[model samples]
Target: MPTQPSLTLAQDLCARLCHDLVGPLGTMAGALDLLDDDAEAAALAREAAASLRARLQVWRAACGAGTGPMTAPEMAALLEGVLGGGRVTADVTALPPGETFAPDVAQLLLVAALLGGEALPRGGVVRLAPAEGGVAVLPAGRVLAWPAALADALAGQEVEGPRQVLAPVLVRLAQAAGWAVSLSAEALTLRPM
Candidate 1:
């Protein structure tokens, strides 16, 4: 069986989720507030709600029990959800329809995208490509902030100290997928054994 994160790490994940959700949640609330006065606001509220729903679906696919053999369109929607109306963009245009990945693999790619977003504080483009055995993530932007410790963990190295809050979970997911994670200044790749 794949390794599961410890309780403390699980709590950290929850905190991260809450952090990411705050903006969209606030958007939904603000949209509703506007609805009381303007008809156009209702449409905006609906859009925000839909965005939230899409993001929730992606979160479920990543962390929930029902990891899907999700279709290309489905995966595209999930990636877009991660964009979250930010300056960052995902180029999933190359993904062919009907192609799917194991849930673990999909989750790792998503998390990698999240990592890329974090690396580019000012926002950038995330490019996706289906490679043999797994996927490739290319982020073009400012300097990447990936810590050396996390890189070692992802490369399947044993580290001594307490793991970074998000490290254990991501490493577990990548390992569960039978993937060897490699990160460079230009891109991150997950290669299956």
Candidate 2:
């Protein structure tokens, strides 16, 4: 990749993260503002702080410095924070006992779950299962429409557009780790190359 393209990719990824974070952050800001009139200011402030902390935990794991190990269940909890309720159910039965993922793979898995959940805006179950040589995300429910260009981007092909932004980052990370990325209506699989 050229220097300019890499820079552009980084910028776009930043934008996507900001877009996702803005909601919780904005809510927290509003809660703080409510302190001026609300009688339950302390409770409201505590609730807002908890929400902020949950979001920060997810974002931290998603964009962490890749220095620590993370488990599948931990990732699921962070993902639950992102989904904000019982909207997405996580299943990690296939993860080996005591197995942990490197920071990058853990982040990629969490992001994959997020994408899978987004594919089912009406709510669904996201399963993390053992694949042939790696892991797979199986989302079952109302499968939303996914653009072909975005699929191409997730498969490591260069593409441009707002929807394609984060998929490419996942693809690049998979590539660097010698993993194959696959996308389909039912599931997304990442496996050894």
Candidate 3:
């Protein structure tokens, strides 16, 4: 049987989720307070709500139970929804048309995209493509930074805090899916074990 996440890891993940949600949730709250006074605030609230929904969907796919296989187009849509807006975008053109990924693989891909987004702090494109019997997540931007803590976590080092939690989570997902994680300045690739 697979090992369950430790209590600390679970708590850190919860913290990370709360951190990600707070900004948009706060925006929505503030906008709603001014909704009757300003028409623009209603639009702001809608945008914030959309961002929150997109984030929740991506998180569900990454951390929740598998929902079965997903086609490339479906995956692309989800990636676009989650990674779109702000400075980052998702490009799925390289994914083969009509191709499908098993639920575990799909989850891994979603987590990989999240990591790719992290690598691009100044806004960039996260490209997903077929790799050697697996998938490759490529992050391109003017300034690419692979966080040191994230790198350590992915290397199976002790996770320091909530900010680096996703790295270990990604490692676990790759392990469960029988994929080997490889990281480089250019891309993070998951190959068959």
Residue 142 C-alpha lDDT in model 3: 90
lDDT of each: 0.68, 0.70, 0.82
* Best of the two (1, 2) by lDDT: 2
- What's the count of clashing pairs in each model shown? 0, 0, 0
Candidate with the greatest lDDT versus the true structure: 3
- In model 2, the worst 10-residue window by lDDT is 77-86
RMSD for each of the candidates = 4.5, 2.9, 3.0
TM-score of each: 0.77, 0.83, 0.92
Query: How much is 71 displaced in model 1, in angstroms?
Result: 4.1
Query: For model 3, how does the per-residue alpha-carbon lDDT over 99-126 read when each residue is reduced to its tens digit?
Result: 8888998888888888888888888999
Q: Which 10 successive residues of model 1 have the least lDDT summed? A: 158-167
TM-score of candidate 2 relative to the true fold: 0.83
In angstroms, the error of model 1 at 55 is: 2.1
Q: What lDDT is reached at residue 102 by model 1?
A: 67
